[model samples]
Target: MCRWLAYSGTPLLLDTILYRPKHSLIDQSLHARMGVETTNGDGFGIGWYAPESGSDTPAILRDIGPAWNNRNLREIAQHVKSHLLFAHIRASTGTAVQQTNCHPFRHGRWMWMHNGSVKGFHEMRRELSLAVDPGLFLDIEGTTDSEVMFFLAMTLGLEEDPPQAVAKMVGLLERTGREHGIAAPVQMTVAVTDGTTVWAFRYASEGGARSLYYSTKVDSLRAQHPDATYLQELSEDTRLIVSEPLGDLPGAWNEVPEHSYGIVHGGHDSLHEFAPIMP
Candidate 1:
């Protein structure tokens, strides 16, 4: 399993969310409180959409090393600014420890990351890979089930309806796994974005999913704790959705209900029940 965080708000230095928080993602990389494992140091990655002039697409920086010891990450985090970002720390389930296996996988304007695994991934890998469109298949650069799941969503129309397409892809994987006698085909807590909007899902073929959480009402928190230093420093529209709360700010986090998805854009947020797509 792994730990990840997604940010959608007024552009700010990456350090504000990745390092400044009391329980920042970098801290979670070594001291995760809710993940299956406390340490997720296999590798880490960060994806962010720079202003149009910065680059043609989201800039991705990935490495096969511990987040806590990455000097380059610290340097970039202090300078880069983006309205949408995805950062992940990995604890490999079955994949080799390589840079490509790090999360926050990118595709055009979209960036994705995942925690948890595709149960019996070795058994389902072939079928899953074969299902990807040839065009998309050629783009896959890694062997992690997380990356495979990303391509599967794109093959099934992630750009159009990310949540639905991901659900369909997961459903297909589960069905294919069942055909091969795998009762629990998928286990995932995934987050994705197309630069502007974000979609996060928590689900598993076995009915028990990994930990996923989102922040609470920014307005509510600001009103309740006007003196909270960070709350006063942040933009009124700032919002964070993560695998765990960044801090213990009372009334500052909400648990995403099991088997559900969350969407965030322009400071607004919504959640939907996750349903498997029938073959």
Candidate 2:
């Protein structure tokens, strides 16, 4: 398992989101409260879009080291700023702990990260890999099921329709798992963004998907804590979707309903039930 967060809204320094919270992702790197593992130190990565660059492709910084102690991460977090970004800490289910195996995988103008696994991935690896588009297959650089799932969704049409493509990807995973005698094949809380809008999903083949949460609307938070200067500094559209809440502020976070997905985009967010459809 792993932990991750996606932010979209006003441009912000990465430090404010990654390290400022009481139970920040860096804190979770050593003391996760809701994850299957308390320590997710195998590796970590961050991907962010710089609209000023006049390009959609995101800049990614990843390393095969514990994020909590990575000086490079600390330095970058303080200096770089972006309107949208993704951060992930990894706890390998079985994959090698290399930089390439880190989360927040990127392709062109899109970036993705996941916090759960494809059960019995080794047995189902070949089938899933073969399902990826031939043109995209050559781009697969890591063995983690997370990356495979990303490309699988892209092959299924992520570039055009994210929700449908992801549903199709899960459908393919479940179908293949059944063929291999695995009862519950998929468990994921995934986030994907195309530099503008972010789509997050929480689902599992069996019930009990990993935990996921999204911040309450900025306007609501402002009303709840009128004196909180931080809330006032943010734009009305500021939003965060995380594997867990960054803090325990009342009315500040909502659990994403199980087997559902949500899209966060400039105050026009929406949540809907998710179901797998054969690809």
Candidate 3:
């Protein structure tokens, strides 16, 4: 189990969201309210797109250490600014605790992070590895099922059709798990981005997925709590999608439906049913 958050909107200092919230991601690293484990101190990572001349590749800073105790993280958070960002705190399921195992795995201009596990991952590892394209296989730098899942999506065309490719990859993963006698083959709440748009999925083979939530209508929130103060501080187009609501503001979050995927970009959002991939 892990906790993660994705931000897409006007560029702002990372600390504003990763540290300033009442219960920020760093706080959740030690006291996650809805994760399977309260503490996710195994490791952490952050990925952000920097303003460049003609490229959109995100610069990522990852470490195999507790986010709460990392002085470098605090320094960078205050200095960096980006329109798209991802931060993750890990609680290793069975993977080794190493820097490479940290989330916000990168490939080309794309970045990804996961907050759940692939059931019976050990048994399905080989089969899953064999499915990745050789090019992607060479790029895999870690041994976590999360990284494997990211490569799988890339194999199935993540850069082109993120939502569909992810659905296909998950479908294959669930099928392979069941083939190995795993009843609930997968449990994942994943988020992937290409520096421009973000795609998040909530699904489980057994139909009981982990928690995933997205912010409520930005316009609606502004109208309802016109003087919430903080609400007025952000750009009208800013949005956050996370493993859990960042705060308890009423009507500030919406639970993503089971077996569904959410796409956020250009000040708009959409959710679609996820169809399992067939063998």
Pick the TM-score winner.
2
Query: Looking at candidate 2, what is the lDDT of residue 41?
Result: 97
Q: Rank the candidates by lDDT, best first.
A: 2, 3, 1
C-alpha lDDT values of all predictions: 0.88, 0.94, 0.89
- lDDT per residue for candidate 3 within 1-279, as digits (tens), equals 999999998789999989998778999998899999999999999999986636777788889899999999999999888889999999999899899999899988999999888888988899999999997799999999999999999999888888878888988887787789887778899999998888899988776788889987667899989888877767777889988888888899899999899989888889999877763
User: How would the candidate models be sorted by TM-score, starting from the highest?
Assistant: 2, 1, 3
* Tens digit of per-residue lDDT, candidate 2, span 158-182: 9999999999999999989988999
lDDT of 1 at 145: 93
lDDT of 1 by residue, 69-155 (tens): 899999999988888889999999979999888988988878889898887889889988999989989889999999999999999
For candidate 1, give the lDDT of residue 48.
87
Give candidate 2 misplaced runs (Cα > 4 Å): none
Residue-pair clashes per prediction, in order, are 0, 0, 0
lDDT of 1 at 114: 89
Judged by whole-model lDDT over C-alpha atoms, candidate 1 comes out at 0.88
Report how far off residue 4 is in candidate 2 (Å): 0.4
lDDT of 3: 0.89
